[model samples]
Target: MPNSPLHDWDLAPREAIALQKRLAGQVEREDRLDPVGRIAGVDIGFEQDGAITRAAVVVLAWPPGAEGEFEPTTLEIVEQVVHREPTRMPYVPGLLSFREVPAALAAFERLEVRPELVMVDGQGIAHPRRIGVASHLGLWLDLPTIGVAKSRLCGRHREPGPARGDWTPLVDGPDDEVIGAVLRSRVKVKPIFVSPGHRLTLPTALDWVIRCLGRTKLPEPTRLADRLASRRGR
Candidate 1:
């Protein structure tokens, strides 16, 4: 796996969080490049021993429009990284990005195709620090990215209407500043958490995610990465 200029395994847990917070404050909330070209997704899983960590990255050439299905001609890459199996990080409400970012970065390094944008299966600026795994990764890579999470991490929301495409703003705090959105990507299915990861806005992230959705619950790139990562277990 490629080493990140920002990574430091020697740092204590508290120091890591502080480093992440410090880095979070420096990210520019502006889209520096267009992401209508290729896209990638990353995911990580563990081996039976739980001491070995496996990560997979899948990059697909995405054309424009709903008909522009993610081509199966993806560059599927995988790698195994050292894992110490530290006690699961405390469910610190808004800091999961810290727990998972390291593994995700390892997976990202195995990618053969550098995508224009990367959609991570985690959070983004929708967190308490305005930075999550997606944001952290994007900043590190200097690439546009978005977070498409399966579960809500932090933020409040009114249940979206019972229909596909229905959504409501995700309130960050008491002031209700919209941080993200609860989008019903599929009818009758639980909503997906859509947030701006880096170099993109919440609306742009949602638009791209919707464009990438197919006849499945998750986006194509993410779904592909999940399958590829799972296959390493066998």
Candidate 2:
């Protein structure tokens, strides 16, 4: 069966903020995942210069090792889905999920195989309301998800060591609470932000993303999805 609506999508910024706060408390921060055999990557974008919201989801086999900057030889893609719809709402600074997640959920609903874990190209608990695109999608799908974002949406962090796996904690608030980690997926390329979206801890999120890295700055699953969604460079 297709996924039902998690909440009303047609929302004002204020309503979205309140909904984010309500959903944020529902996100599980502990490792409570089944044995992960398949992983999915999500990429959200726009088409026709913002008239359409496009979402891509790519499912790949798991256990691809964290090798150096070389494409994985055994990376296997099992499924992929793309969903596009009219842009729902204007972009709001702290309410990105409200603008992006509806299409993502549609893409996931169209997927043939349900991935055990998901990696999203956006923030997770690192958002101001602790509910970025990844976290919001996770709540809707009830799946374990990790935010493998190219940039940090919130929190401050020291520079991670310029190596394949070195990472630094990304902290927020007065207490300096650790929300995520900044990771260098490649030796010299830009680092990525890794945060647990749902049903996983921050450390577990980092481990899953590291496990999927292959050659590029973005991991295999996400890289493919981004390329698919953007219809551009790999």
Candidate 3:
């Protein structure tokens, strides 16, 4: 397991916002990722009446297949790990990492096979502060990561076409800066928000995410993680 203390997780809202501003600069929107083979998807779910935070990490070996033809049968699952800890922070709308990341770090600590890249189930730079959970965890783990959010947090974008490869730029309305991409991973299914977390560019993030797609709306790694996080609580 890899570990690095990037910052203190215990803080008030003001302090968390300040830390986000400082770390937002460290996020590299340009491509800095190595040749990826293993990819991990992470998700945090609450249990014990929202008092326990359960973080699940699912690692999958990237399959060699043609673009837009990702079949689940071809991919291999390398590892699946979960860690649980009592929730420390309240559910704040914008400061989600503060509430979710502590448990995620614990889950990462249990990982035996370090993934080359990680896919977090949250936003990256596509936030009001541009420091969502994906970016936050990436800075701590110092690994290439992507934000594979199921819904939009901030930014505006046209509805992507109902096709697997169709996408549109997710832009900040005020500055008109492109922050991420709204990608249609499965035909006629709701698109997922794809953003560069750390050590990755938006284009590369979308490419990898599209490659990881199977016969589901969410990618295989995050989808499996989501299932594990949900099912483990019961």
Candidate 4:
């Protein structure tokens, strides 16, 4: 079940920051997911000179393909939905959910086939407020989500080895708390940051990301969603 109006969307940056702190406490830090059968990719883009926010959700069959016969190019798109609306909140650093998530929730509501697990193209708990776009979306949608960001938003980490699957701990705070993982999704590519969004653990989040990886630096789920978003943005 999805969340029932967690909080208001109309607020100033200061109000939004306060909300993030309150919501951060409710975020589940342990694994609380069911058996996964379908997976979805959630992505956001802009159009009309950043006036229109475009969100995409692409649901794919779980287990991708038979063993090593996996073909990301031919993966079945069980369902796809796109939503666009006037930008609700302007771009605010460390406040991505406030800017991009209103339309994302709308897109998910339009999906005919709901996904059991989701891969989002943004930050999760690796944000300053501990609530990034993926975590925010998961709280609203009530589905397991992982943040698979192309770049680091917060925290620090050691360099991962230059090989597929090599990863290092992304830590924060003076005590060195693990916030996420810096992962080498593909060889000769920059590392991606992986973090638990909701209803999942860090290890489980990392494991699913590795399973969904395609030939590119991104996993199959978010990779396809990114392509779909780019085409629609034009």
Candidate 5:
């Protein structure tokens, strides 16, 4: 069983925003974990039927060196929950965290191995309020997490170099207080938006994401979770 109390379709825009604001204040930044152990990736997919949500969580052991790669084994532990309520909230630019977190949390509860850190397929503190889906989940679980979004959400930065591994800081404003980094994980591939979700710093988040990049554009955990979620929906 998972710990999700509300469904995606059940929340109104105003109610969801208020709930996020309430949760944002509860974030405990002092107890962040330094992830030297296992790591997990979480993603959610909705069935075309629009009645069911499938959440997938994939765990991969860490500490892979420069040449090492992530060979994630699908854990047998998996769970699915249904939300019969219709999705009332329309797609909004900054409020996506509310749309996805419920299903993500459901999948996370079924993980047999607790990961020291989690990477979500969305934004983190790089968001307008410094609270994206990754940040929201980190606050709820009190776990160190990072947001590895496929597209740029907010902020400005220089384009990374043509070569892989080259990166530039993502500044939140003219003062140059770095909120995250635009990392070139793979050559000729679009850079991923990496931001600290909770407990960890931007530098640490970038290092972990870079290390986890295997033979693909996305990190192994996120890639695997995405695959599973997409497949399960079919």
Candidate 6:
């Protein structure tokens, strides 16, 4: 599914903002996926004092017998890919995609199985400019993707109930636009922000993320990816 070229990562702050604005227009806020049998979680870890970036993608299989069932279950890791590369872009607020996505894309290229959907560990349309890492990479890969972020980059929302599957609409405070969701993945744990990255509606994104969650606060795919990325660079 590697269909198109992503924009250049190296750029000035002004140029990056411009790029985000241009790319944000292409993000699709509709459900555009067929039956998804596999999903991937993507994350990046830095080493060597941010000199080396290690990116990991872990794919999980969803057997056909049950879809949409959110019971606690173990999903098999069908494929995993990790790529280490020199860090090219410096950290910038709201432009974290440019800092990490190149390495993540390299790892994505090495994946033996292309996932039907990807869950990225960052924001999506929830950003100020509405082009977070998940949206950025999803557009480049041209696949259905969701953003499952631990913290907020933009928007405000009411705290969801302290129970699994609880969620509330995340709205842009200033514009009062519904952008994403605040989802409680586990009881008593901090909720994660869920947003549509590309080729998915906000509801669909939240649905898939909840389905992927087991006992952990984060979804299995993303939790595994986080572990993989965290351990690889150490």
Identify the leading candidate in terms of TM-score: 4
| 53-140 per-residue lDDT for model 4 (tens digits) | 8888889987655535223455577988888888878888888898878888889888887789999999889988789999998998
Query: Which residues of candidate 6, in runs, are more than 4 Å off?
Result: 1-7, 64-72, 232-234
| Candidate 5: residue pairs that collide | 9-87
Tell me how far the alpha carbon of residue 112 in candidate 5 is from the true structure, in angstroms, after superposition: 2.0
lDDT by residue (tens digit), candidate 2, 1-234: 134454487788778788888899999999999998898989987889899988988898865543443456466788888888888788877888888888888898888888899998888899987888889889999999888888978899999998798999999999999999999999888899988899899989988787777767887778888988896744
Identify the runs in model 2 with alpha carbons over 4 angstroms from their true place. 1-7, 64-71
**Residue pairs of candidate 2 with colliding backbone atoms:** none
Q: Regarding lDDT, does 3 or 5 come out ahead?
A: 3
For model 1, residues 1-234, the per-residue Cα lDDT tens digits are 147553463355677678778988876676666645678887655666455555666777767333644323333333222222332233355666555666666666655557888888878888877888788889878899888888887899999998767889999787888888898878789989889889888888888888788767788777777776666423
| Collision count for each candidate, in order | 0, 0, 0, 0, 1, 0
Tens digits of lDDT, candidate 3, 208-232: 8887888888888888899888865
Give the winner by lDDT: 6
The CA-based lDDT of model 2 is what? Answer: 0.85
Collision pairs in model 1: none
lDDT of 6 by residue, 1-234 (tens): 144354467779999999899999999988899788898999998889999998999999876344445653658779898899888888887999999888888898888888899999999888999989999999989999899899988887899988789899999966799989999898888899999999999989988888888778898778889999998423
lDDT of 3 at 189: 82
Using all chains and alpha carbons, the TM-scores for the candidates as numbered come to: 0.81, 0.92, 0.92, 0.93, 0.81, 0.92
lDDT of each: 0.72, 0.85, 0.86, 0.86, 0.73, 0.87
Model 2 residue 140 lDDT?
A: 91
Model 4 Cα shift for residue 127 (angstroms): 0.9
